[model samples]
Target chain A: MLSTKEIKQSIRSISSIKQITRAMEMVAASRLKKVESRVLASRAYTERMQQVLSHLASSIPSERSHPLFTQKESVPVIKIVLITADKGLCGAYNNNIIQTTAKFIKENTGNTIKLIHIGKKGNLYFSKGGYTIEKYYPENVEKFGYNQVKTLASQLIDGYEAGEFGQLHIFFTKFKTTMQYSPTSIRLLPIEKDAIKTKVIAKGEYIFEPSAEQIIEHLFPKYIETQIYQCILESLTSEYAARRVAMIAATENAGEMIDELTRSYNKARQETITKELLEVISGAEALIKG
Target chain B: MAKTFKIEVITPEKVVYDDTVQSITAEGTEGSFGVLADHASMIAELQTGILTISDVNNKTVRFALDGGFVEILANNVIVLTDTCTKEGEVDVEKAMAEKASAEKALLKVGSGVEKEKAKAALKRANTLLKLANK
Candidate 1:
């Protein structure tokens, strides 16, 4: 049973917290809206890119001929690119993504795993716990430009081609909406060719300006870089959505706490006043009897 | 009767322009080339430059297409590349800035191939700015 003063103090502190959370929630929501618009605008480009890639893959006879798809003669250690948000308070968004990564690492067992963190949160957690990060690209979160992502993609693909990494997997949180997010990990190495994919055929066949093999070596790297850039965009958008939902919930919880404390304060005040009134009545009655 | 074929500027991102055009002047690897309707089935590697698509009215709409493959099949031009901008949508200031950077890169390059790429970037940026301002 807290005294009225204590209850009132608790209410004041809770109200202050409520204000901060409410402001955070609004900011997150606005950012989420902007990100969603960007995603929508880019979605059109993404579809077209896929078509172009499909056309290129089908036109070229040998995908393995490209170094991006070709594996080294000897199998070596594997690496993974793990992307997580820098800030917390977004419900279980960060936790879920990290857990998925943990499960994957556990299941693989024999593979040598390394992290390439895109966000501060992922870098902090993975490094603080003694995980070796092969590389981290936090610039993707602050200002996402295609060039930066393309550079990273080239480094990884070229490294893979040079036998630095045997296999690669990238992980991030996929944004569905303000209340929904899913962690996604996908394998992007070794572009395999299905007969249907290969046989789709180019409508008009022309001689390659240089050679068919040369065009592919250049195009394949660009494709991978664009794919990774898209992943970063999706992850950042999801982070904002998660933050907005988490802050909104926090604000509501604060409101509930304020209400509960007000009730407790009122009850305590009433009890104190009743005791004082009873004492006054007894004193008057004692005086009347004398 | 003159034959006009459809010039569909389909990018990996979206179909930017799809219409019946008179001809398309594109930068090809061997040199510059023009595409008219009913051209034989062929593939051409495009350099960064201004791709002009002329409508039936003979009005030319220019687009700055980055590096990509151009597929001409049955009168359609499918362009797959990293960046694209229509003349009306281009930011002249940004294009000028990009052009300046590319020019700077070319001045400091070590190889002929690197110089060519930088020159192509500058040319593309300049093309966009010119068309947008015009």
Candidate 2:
């Protein structure tokens, strides 16, 4: 028979684990709140930027003048920038992106595709799967800032302008709601036609300051950078939300385990007491008979 | 009639200024331009300079902008900037320090991307300092 001491030890270990998971859940919840506020605040800037870009794209004549607007004739090479979290234990947060990238590579068998990894998880997964990693962002994902995104944007712009890659795509988790995030792929290069459509206001006749061409030369690059920055912000918010949900689930599971262990521990103690009482009664009965 | 139009100055951080205004003067990439109520629709690239607005109360509010763009509609003008600070909100000593450091970096770096970045930083710092002093 198992001793009561062993049962007590199991109960103690389970309770300690429950405490740790509860603490982690609280931490994730607080971080999620901060990121959610930031995402909400940045939405205004992104919406205004989109409006301005669409206005320029629709109003201006000769849209093919800017290099960003023009597309190459045939697709030669493709670049995919995959974003994942550095840390694990966030449920399927990193797994979803990794699997999506794997599927993408599997489908595009003949294309010359190069991978650009933003977080360590994606890099570790793809590198093992025998994919060519063009670059891996060295900085920790938690410490991301606008300045880092700007530098990366500049590099991408330079490469796109130089015709290094015929097509560029970015894979990230789009934050739909606090409880839901979906993995999405968006084309980043050559500026998609529908993305510049303005739904807010009617098209109006406008004057360009230097010229439409000159203004576009400046606006297009900024527009690209803003899009990248927004995606990063959204991904960060989603990561926290995912982590919070995962931790909550883990904490609940730990609670259930602790409950089960406590019940078993109590049952073992009761059985031990009953056996000792019977033995004492028998011993007294034998002495009286003698 | 108050004879006012709406203007919203937004950055990545937040909406710095949003109000009905009488008039506004902004430094465009080509030159300085002023907008009044019912001005013709236009899109202009902004430089690192001051954006002066005359509010509905005829009180002039000035903002220092760090190189963005201005969009003018019939009744609304929206300014999209990387960094926008109110004249009163700026700290001159801090801006002066940033300017000095940027200038030093520019001089130290012979020629590269860092030099260009430092030059741009110096320009933005100077704009902030000027707006604060004014």
Best by lDDT: 2
Model 1, docking class: acceptable
DockQ of 1: 0.38
Docking class of 2: medium
lDDT of 2 at B55: 95
Kindly list the per-residue Cα lDDT of model 2 for residues A1-290, writing each as its tens digit: 55778877887887788788788888878988888888877888987887787777767556445776667636677899888998887889999988987898888877888998888899999888578899998677768677887788888888888888878888888887979999888777866667543443355568889788888888877887777778777788888889889888888888888788778878888998999999999999999999
Question: TM-score of chain B only, all predictions?
Answer: 0.77, 0.92
- Tens-place lDDT per residue, model 1, A1-290, is 89888889999999999999999999988888887777655655554554555555556555345565555535546677877887888888888888998898888767677788888777877877667788877664848577777787888877787777677888988777667779998665655344333332444454565566666666667667766776777788888998888898899999999998898899999999999999999999999999
Compose the digit string of candidate 1's lDDT tens values, residues B89-111.
98888888999999899879969
Candidate-wise lDDT, in order: 0.75, 0.84
Two-chain DockQ for model 2: 0.62
* lDDT, residue B34, candidate 2: 89
| Cα distance off (Å), candidate 1, residue A184 | 1.4
